[model samples]
Target: MSHHMTKNHPDSPNGQDDISKNDSGNPTIHEIIDIRLSRRGLLKGGAGMVAGGFMSMGLSACVSDSSKTATTAKGFSLGFTAVAKSLNDVLSVPTGYTASILYRTGDPINGATPAYVNDGTDTAASFDFRAGDHHDGMAYFGMASGGSGMDLNNSSRGIVCMNHENINQQFLHTAAEAGVGFSTAARVAAQIDKEVNAHGVSVIEISKAGGTFSVNTASTYNRRLTAASDMDIYGPARGDTLMVTSYSNAGQKTRGTLNNCAMGITPWGTYLTCEENWAGYFKRPASGGLSAKMATAQNRYIGSSSSNGSYGWANPTGGDTSGTGLYDRWNINLTGADATADYRYAANTFGWVVEIDPFAPASIPRKRTALGRFGHEGAMPAPAVAGKPVVFYMGDDSRGEYIYKYVSTANWSSADVGGGLAAGNKYLDDGKFYVAKFNSDGSGSWVELNIANPTISGYATYAFANQADVLINCRLAADAVGATPMDRPEWTGVNPSTGDIYITLTNNSDRGKTGTTTGGKSRGLDAANPRYYSDLKGAATQTGNVNGHIIRIRESAKDHSATTFQWDIYLFGAEAGADATNINVSSLTADNDFSSPDGLWFSRAVPGLMWLQTDDGAYTDVTNCMMLAALPGTMGDGAATTITNTAVPANGNANQTVATIAGKKATTDTLRRFLVGPKGCEITGITETPDGQTIFVNIQHPGENTALADVASNTTASFESHWPDGGNARPRSATVVITKNGGGLIGS
Candidate 1:
């Protein structure tokens, strides 16, 4: 989610409030000694290359001049000069590469649809045939030559399935803000319809030719799944009473997905779009008291709120003539006779990993509830080993939330490569769910989140009725099991060679901050979230670990089903010139410094190569958000260390010394900045072609800082940045295709 969307809201300027109360004496990770240590042998050895399943497709003769930076051919190495930190209104890349727009908001999906005007004049009905807004997580599924079925190895033609996380409200309406054009008492029905339609997932066809990629607007597989589309609820939570709503009285279905952030790609050629920040879309009035069970779930997920959702989507009237209350379903209040008579249970149907078949555009999406929903960032699956259960790693994106994983009951089979959602039913529907518990000694264990677990079975705060209840109210179950509360765990990525899981803790301002308590426990300093410092933002000062860090873990015996693992803080994010003793723990230089790591992905074709993306608000004064290329080491590569955290002025706290495990510090060889995005945008959602020569990245919410009042004036000065489609055009969220000038592995 974009922090710029809620910059003026009551919550922190960082998009979410820390809502988890996991104060069980857990430890946070910290670094010490301000060291600049590098193992030159490791970079030359090229270890983990073949192990990561990469074939030596030697560089093409057409390789660009930038590839001359490759010092050795042993393992995967970054081959381009790091792009300098930039504040320009355009995307910047290395000298020998190009970043061109691929698909953009309101781009026509089919030949019948007209080109987007982008003047806040597009009708609501047209959005179903056009591209949605705010593109987030995405996956590219290769299609057969005839555009009929899956072709996992096809590099030239494929289907790009992406998430439209949300809308730039000011640009979507004719009069900028919602209440400007229509009634002051309620939102305009047409504007609300257009906004809702613009939020969901998009499946479009794309082709590559002459070293350039473009959307295939006339392809048959192109389609849009909006907020009004039908979806089937699957897994243990299906048909549960808590899921009943006016739209689905049987509780076996729900309307559509919302706030889709990160993503995952299945071996069977399907897309897993995660639902993050969905709780903030429902309307729950404080005047209407909730049932004890309902109240516990609502408060735990969304916190206590007396107002409508972020956009007040339910404030509009007279749009539900079919008696299903299409506009009214956004409200979660208990009205009318019972659950079936109203949308009180609508919130329970969201917060899941929805499975969609990009190859089969006519199929209905399935909400896989077996994943145990709680602000799902992404559901990244480990490599599917034969005769072993398929394992998927997940992270809850809210502050103080827990990390989760699911192991399937059935063994993996290569024959199911084209199984589509049928493969999902066999693997994702019935699984054993778990939450991670990190220990102070660099070791960790997974706590099974089953209804039969003693801690969950006998909980006193809110009794879980059954397995379904436990899945719906997963945060409560994790709380009961004493899962480790992390620093805003956002994305989980599995190493292609090592079977290790890497998670991004995108900064938690509440970590170790005084006077901030939950469940009678204060969020103090610990090993897993060690830093507690302050940074000045204009006139205001922000505290806590504002720069964030990434942690990695390896399953015991390289088994995804293993309940035990080893973990370490892989890298710390800080400014290049910050205090090296406490803040710049990673020993970063100007070439590779970054803050707020959000989207992370491992290249399938390049083996050990990994890509990192940022959604930052803390470092905007220096540069826009960016993406980086890195070759990481294994767990426990660095020694344990201790650091002292000085208290922020005016914040009530004292200096505290904490010891934590630190991985090998980043170096110019192991990490380097690759691309810097446009102004007021986040660099998220990355995917590469089968050959690893071409890659796609999403730029979300460009020019988002534009004032609503200036939107209707229609001038170039009204926007913070005019990018992708330059000149005086309104800014749009879009996907850019990056490639070496000629033909060579990207970053090679």
Candidate 2:
């Protein structure tokens, strides 16, 4: 969803393009100028942290020197100084590190296809054989050779699967020079075909021959699952009446998966690629008057949009199927009268957690519907323990949506390691969906979303027909059960060392709206989602948790499958210039303050090494989105702080004045900004080999804010930043490998 913050693409004639999946209603939050720190406080705090001033230099040298490098009390450490915050148009890293392009958009999956020309002329047919754009959540899996030279955790030969969230249309064709729109109907149709082929996940075989990793395009393991690939639908929702469509009459299959964002690697060796922000791709006619039930359900999942879609593929003009070809199926509104007659039920087929067997190139992907369907972010699993149920923690990824957990009905067994979808059936097909409810006492409960629950069964407005209905309308069901609505929840990660679960609650400007606080129309701040403040970034005013925060929960006794858990706010994002006590809750200085914590991962290879990434809109005025490394402590390591609101009117439209309370805070030594990305890009999708020497990270849509007119120009000066492929090349979304200077483990 970070890509949503960028400028709209020129070819998007519909203006239906939405990068921030959902918009905040209040849009702007009021900042209290009265809360400013006094002269002495300013000299000692926030502004004093900035360099160049005499006292600041003295304070910076003495106070921050001890915390500048990433070091853990447990003894593992980072010797490099934090990467300097940069306005330069290139990737920035610590001095000893190096970054190289490993794979990029349109890179071939086979040797038969040549390298990308970077000039928008790559053929549409060739796209299916190429890598895709906006690289996101990915994973590296070791392939055991079972011979003399290789072991179970072999670092040399492995597979890398990446989620291609969506396409960057501006870079797809020869500089949109004559105007941004297409020149011909044929060109438009062909471009749409290419875009569809680039909208899912890329599975490439990578091998290290002379200590340098490269894509094995000729390897049979390389494959792509684009928007047109055939896929199977699994779980109780598989053949449900609501899922039947002309594309899959038996309700067992669907065509393609789109808007793939975050991901998870299953214990069975398959990869779970999540379908995110997928609803915008479909065009549903308002006049269709789809059933009351269908309308309610569809709205809950996809929400509502004004345009047909970013691309009018479903309702294209000219001769393809006379506007009713395989592409026409994207329009989900009623057309042919019955469910199986047309693609009226097409939208239901997506918004799923698609499972891909990275090892089996020919195996079709399956949509595990039991994971529930909202704007899914990622499906992060806790470690699989023998005799215990496998658990996956997930976030809904919308403003004020609920966090969730899926507990498998079946117990875990090492025997199912490579079982594939059959393993999915035994473990994922049936599970208990639970929503989180944080209480005042620093404890929380997982409110079950079971169809039989009284809260769901007795809900009068939205009928709960079955378990499938509850999962299909998960947001509605969570609301019906009174689950806590948090700021936008994105990625979830489980600490490999301590088993604490952490979720990135990206900024939500809608949280403290006129009538949305606790005593008001909507939910208010709780212990887990404590601070609710406004951010003022150059003339722009953003309120209601504008900088976002990360919350970590330790399941009861560290049992991942436990129903009740104790939670605390691990870190709150803020600007280095903001009020230290109010916004800079984590006590951050200019070196590490960040906003919109999006991608997070706990390194399995390097214990205690956690990587934090930013896909932000709030802090762009100060710096580009960045990636950070942290040595996180388990839950309850810091004291809880309280929040008070003085601007509340007696009418109770906003947050009312409340007593100060304490909340969880991270130790300063725990988190530090490791790398900052280039201009107009988000730092996302991270993976490292088992040995922890090579880390793969994605830099998405760099130079994305350039004007369409600039994009169409002949001079390279028209671009915001030509990066990765420097010297006038169009900015391309790519994955890079980060290696230490002399083969030391990452974050060391």
Candidate 3:
């Protein structure tokens, strides 16, 4: 999850912090956009969400002060005792559940392709037609049945699409060894080609027969979208000057999608593959940095001033000039004789919401830039009600970032179910964008990001010329408004049985790091962001909210497009041995304790059932990351909690020593651990069939801690795990399908 922290992508400044640069455009294009989120409150001097630990409550979203229980809370039991934690290198489920390998890295896609050899000898070219590394965020699109759109109940046969978040270098090459960079290896063109081809998303067909699920590679729907595939641009910014590349002088086209993390499934039967941490993958020449127009844009998202990236694909020891535009594409330095001559504008094409149709392999993907670009974690849609505007909730996965939402101009309808890209035009594009502001007092507001608003137009900190400029430089716009900064925001999930939406705030080490955070941002404990602590892992001390927590919100009046919301902390992640009063604020026991809430999903087939997964470091000493099942109660079920942080203080800020936080608590009967993964692994990427009888989950980067020196001997003993392919063999990122041994509904 923090892979970007280790690698230096000279051309990509995706996660790095930088100041804004210059722009060349007409100064009056902001006239055509929507601006209600700001005009109503922010522009009129309305108080925004602030940095306070707690505040007195005064209002409500739906339920009144007398009772905080949501109208749709589920208090049913999970029905199973929690699974025991273990260090074994295998996927474990409840005793009645069985699991099998569905697919793994290097696995072939069609009948002509051979099986995965599970070694480092496979040809780099072969990976172009195989499953990729680091599987993440997937959704099941039921069979379209030839033009009637999709039947959500078609559980027998369907299409599955998933993201290949990033690469695992040690296992990706033929002669990988410690101390030698995979991209720096001799004659790395082939190796570079393989990694690039394997970094996007894959669409495969799956069908159930008798009792097992199998991939039908021969199906015409089987396909792969690499980082170099041709795609069209959509939304108001599609034909703008910022997108004028040699590939599309008209600024209507671009190539490939990169760093795809979490994704979303649309009600219109399409999939939204999110581009995350995409800024730091390219390098710009120092001289090119002089072009304030381009540099200004790059600095906002962090464009490195070097000529190489994490892999040196553009400037490898072996000349990149001989390749089929393959190697040169990685370099975004202005050395390109012109926009067309070099990939100077190539970086502009990435970092947007990419829409793909899994049922139609021949269809071109569209980069919907109107969604307000940043390090998009994922997009989760509110319940789609006919005649109502579709609402999508998204999070920017970075430290001290803001949460956003997009409200479509078009209303929902069944007729547009199979409309495909046309449906995207009706909903994904031309929307009102707003950032969230959480108040310590339970109430929160959605701050509009409209340039026309006086709050934005009157601000002199940054330049906002038009709607296109506003969308391109969204982070700056969010900052101009008083959006509440948060911990590392990850995946978001919404309850179908209830209108409540939940977002996972992964741990943030910098929270309350120093008295003065230096960047004008405060890291002190606030009512909305309550906990701050330090933890010891081995010899290193992990600080801030080490275990992380989950926040749930209900829209005012239960309306998806409501500008206000009522929220509370749903659960606080922690180790079973942690203090119940301070660390384990949710009062979690051995059966429900967990940390670093990362991946979250609601069972589409099982109403009221939510699946919670983790990607942890603070508690690995006890067991690896795992997934849990919860029958969640409403946000107001429990009383507010107060934490007295007693850690070493820095900067000018002293120990809070006392901070009262408000949030509901989770009981053992309401939530229980369902499965534990192997050592050195993260449990992520989850989905299930419409019937809820079969579920698919990804085990990413297993045995990732193995040192390169240990793997040189090429033995299973050199690694920390080899389950799912037991015996002396290398471990691979794989998708496991789990089902009840007696055919019961999952989580039933």
Best-performing candidate as measured by TM-score:
1
- TM-score of predicted model 3? 0.87
Clashes of each: 9, 9, 22
Which candidate number has the best lDDT? Answer: 1
lDDT of 1 by residue, 67-92 (tens): 33533334667878777787777777
Kindly provide the TM-score of model 1 when superposed on the true structure, using C-alpha atoms: 0.92
Candidates' lDDT values, in order? 0.79, 0.72, 0.71
177-260 per-residue lDDT for model 3 (tens digits): 333555432336666777777788888888888888888878877877888788899997888877777667788987788888
Error in Å for residue 1 of model 2: 25
Better of 2 and 3 by lDDT: 2
Task: Please write out the lDDT profile of model 2 over residues 129-246, one tens digit for every residue.
Answer: 8988888999998876542211238778888999988766767777752256643322366777887887789999888877778998778888989999999999979888778988
Judged by whole-model lDDT over C-alpha atoms, candidate 2 comes out at: 0.72
Model 2, residue 254: C-alpha shift (Å): 0.5
TM-score of each prediction: 0.92, 0.88, 0.87
